[model samples]
Target: MTAPARYPVTVQFGEVNGEPATWAIETLPEALAAVPLGDHGVFIVGAVDPDAFDESDVSVLELLAANAVAAMDAADRRRRLRTYEDALKNVDDMVCVLDGDGAVTYATGPFVSWIGADDLGDVAGRPLDALVDEADAPRVADAVAALTDAATEAGGAPEPTRTVDLTADRDSDRRSRHGELRLSRLSDHGAGVVGSLSDTTDLRRTRTELSAERDRFRRLFDRIPDPVIEVVLEPEETVIDGANPAFEAQFGVDETTLRGRTIDALDIHDDRLGDP
Candidate 1:
């Protein structure tokens, strides 16, 4: 076989000749009929006979190519889905497919492990809301109901996708896991809901710790005895954002009113302000 050539269409053409040629040929074929199979490459058939290839032959090839493309497309989709499932298996997040009634039709391996289930069958057919913490169950239900209502209002059109943060009730020692639940309608007709629950427990804890740290710093800063003022450094000059209680008492002006007012606007004697 020869390398595929791109002309009117991509194809690989070759011929087998012998002392007693079984297949009689008047001329060497230039191109062969072919069909693309996505990333799997092209499927090439017998070489085209320019003289014998008529409109009827063209129709046959077209039909065959159409079927081949469809099959290839389906196979490609399954391959991609397998790859996605494999990736999700190792991830901390859980992927799930829900039916119209919000029942779990399919779930990733992580979900099964998190729930302490032997397999997907343990969770399958269960209401998705049951897996959520009792505190978050109502919120999850409301979100799903709203999507369903919106789809109905739109005359069966797909509802807009939305994401919500909720806690999942796990059977493991973890007990509960904070997750961001991304919910979306699977089809244009709103046939079902597809969602992914990404574990955000660590992220939420980090944010909470950072917030507490910030509050501690603010308390310490405000309690300091020295006259302290926060200023915004500008290209032309500096503007006061706020001043502590000591500075406020010395200046005889409230920090709120002093804010946004430039230091130059203040009455200073003996160039004391220049010392800073």
Candidate 2:
């Protein structure tokens, strides 16, 4: 007895003895057509009788593959753009995009609420300088004008960006808010500018309080009756940075001359009264 041939098979339409018949194909026939999706896989559409495939079939398959890849690329771009927009909307900082003429194009995030605006449209289509405090408006305009001139000189290349600390006036309450504004050219062709505003009102207030406290401490230190000296520790020795007036009188040295001198330089020993 002979062993039966074991081969992978696929069903195909055919005719046997002038009657319709189905037969198993061991391998892909010459008339079979297939299209490959790049890096994905191949699609076998159908198989025909031998010699039925032509050059047109190959062209059609190539065109289909190209179109499929292009469609996939477009979809990917849309997905990424959506993700970026979502992140911008949810961020805590205030972000705005401007047009080439300095009109506001888009604004988003917590800054809208701080400005007491019902929506982004409240500030949109307005000049960026309009929101700045009057005292700072001229400075901001000058900086932007300089940047624009530089971009022109460079044949439309983007100019270096700038950050300015300024105060903004809110429309709703007319309240002044301290913020740091960062400006950057958006395109190589001088298309527009993007601005990011960071609120620093609370931080500036805290810093002011700390500075006043430091000044108060310095005044009290100067008025104290006890002699006091401030020294800086170094690898070789301790150097006196400053000394109070009482310290100067006790040591019989001018406070200015004593500064920057090592503490060991002021050697003192009991000599006039012996053991007293």
* Model 1 agreement with the true structure over 31-64: per-residue lDDT tens digits: 5666565455676655555565567876787787
| TM-score between candidate 1 and the true structure | 0.57
Candidate 1 weakest ten by summed lDDT: 3-12
lDDT digits (tens) for residues 138-223 of candidate 2 = 76665565455455665764456878788766668665678888887653333456678888998998898999997897787677
Clashing pairs in 1: none
| Local accuracy by lDDT, each model | 0.69, 0.69
Instruction: Give stretches of model 1 more than 4 Å off.
Output: 1-93, 115-118, 149-158, 169-175, 231-241, 260-276
**Residue runs of model 2 more than 4 Å from their true location after superposition:** 1-87, 149-158, 169-176, 232-239, 260-262, 265-276
How much lDDT does candidate 1 score? 0.69
